[model samples]
Target: MNIHSVAPKRPDLDRLLIDSALALFAERTYEGTQMPAVAQHAGVGVGSIYRYFPSKEALGNAAFRYAKRTLLDTLAEALADGGPAGTAREEFARFWRGFTRYASAHPDAFVFLEHQQHDTFLDPESRALADELHRVAADFIERGQHAGAIRDGDAEQLVGLALGAFTGLVKLARPAGGLDALPAEDLDRAEAAVWDLLHRKADR
Candidate 1:
């Protein structure tokens, strides 16, 4: 008769809270989401959320890290499967597909991460995760440049440009049921167009 042991484990509850928070963050901006709302979404008492996250800012940071990590992992898996032997063009295609997969499966996370403002409360670890993604992408762009496959530019800027195109495409598709709603041909066209933005041109 150990009712305490039967209760959701701490890690399970933590994930439940974070998932609930992300869902609300997507619907209402992070600034607008309230603790009670998160508790309601998680199907737990308001006190339970506070038990795991000391403050709303703590929950927000956790949600940001979760969403960002999901994105990074998706990209990593795609690149890993393609392997080092692949050409930059091939790798780029894998990277594009990785983004599509992430966006399709976690559209709410994408909206939460992109639609909310994060200037005020992100902590060091959360900030580092954000920077890590930028650095990893810049490394890829630099390698492509060295191979004469990608255009010569500030690698960070190039990453921003490529992802900016992705962000725009996802936004465009969100109303129609997110990235998955787009036809395969449309996705391919968008992917090719984004590559054209980063790829080297003879005149350039």
Candidate 2:
């Protein structure tokens, strides 16, 4: 058996190959990247990549899943440090801003994640993971509603709205200046705008 073919069976090789695939996908769009390039970048044989991920799409899915996990972990840390979920609008804004900054700085990673939802190449497991992430977001929205922080609405619908706003803000901030390109005053204003949308005064 070839060393490359055998390597994929090793746990470490799986991570190594996936990391390389993601890096290439980040730099190049899905259609533009090839398995060979990923293999080369990973310092493994092309066959090795195949052993773990049958196709480029599968590889892309794995990369995207990794990125999502990483982003959520970072968000969790920011939220933990900022304050509890009840009344930390400023902290939440700060976390959102930081998350946006991270995404802008890692456009390749972000684009890979955005594309994952539409990619037909993703395996069943990867698709399941993506669906679970969305469900978790919906659950969080429901929790907020229960806490009297959010307006009464379908949690799933509200999640979609919140994500739309989040992504839209990132896009708006991208060209004029990356997330951090905005001055302190501008960021402050943006932060206030976000909190205002999420936390309006309760209707009598």
State which candidate has the highest lDDT. 1
Q: List the residue pairs that clash in candidate 2.
A: none
Off by over 4 Å in 2: 1-20, 23-28, 37-48, 88-91, 94-98, 175-177
- Measured against the true structure, the TM-scores of the candidates, in listed sequence, are 0.91, 0.70
Error of 2 at 195 (Å): 3.5
- The stretch of ten residues in a row with the least summed lDDT in candidate 2 is 2-11
lDDT of 1: 0.89
- Cα lDDT tens digits, model 2, 1-204, are 656644345358888887777667756866678999988988888899889888777777778778777766666666676456545354456466556655766655665675434455767777787777677666656666676776777777765665666666666766776566767787677666655665546778
How much is the lDDT of residue 136 in candidate 2?
Answer: 60
Q: Return the TM-score for candidate 2, rounded to 2 decimals.
A: 0.70
Clashes of 2: 0
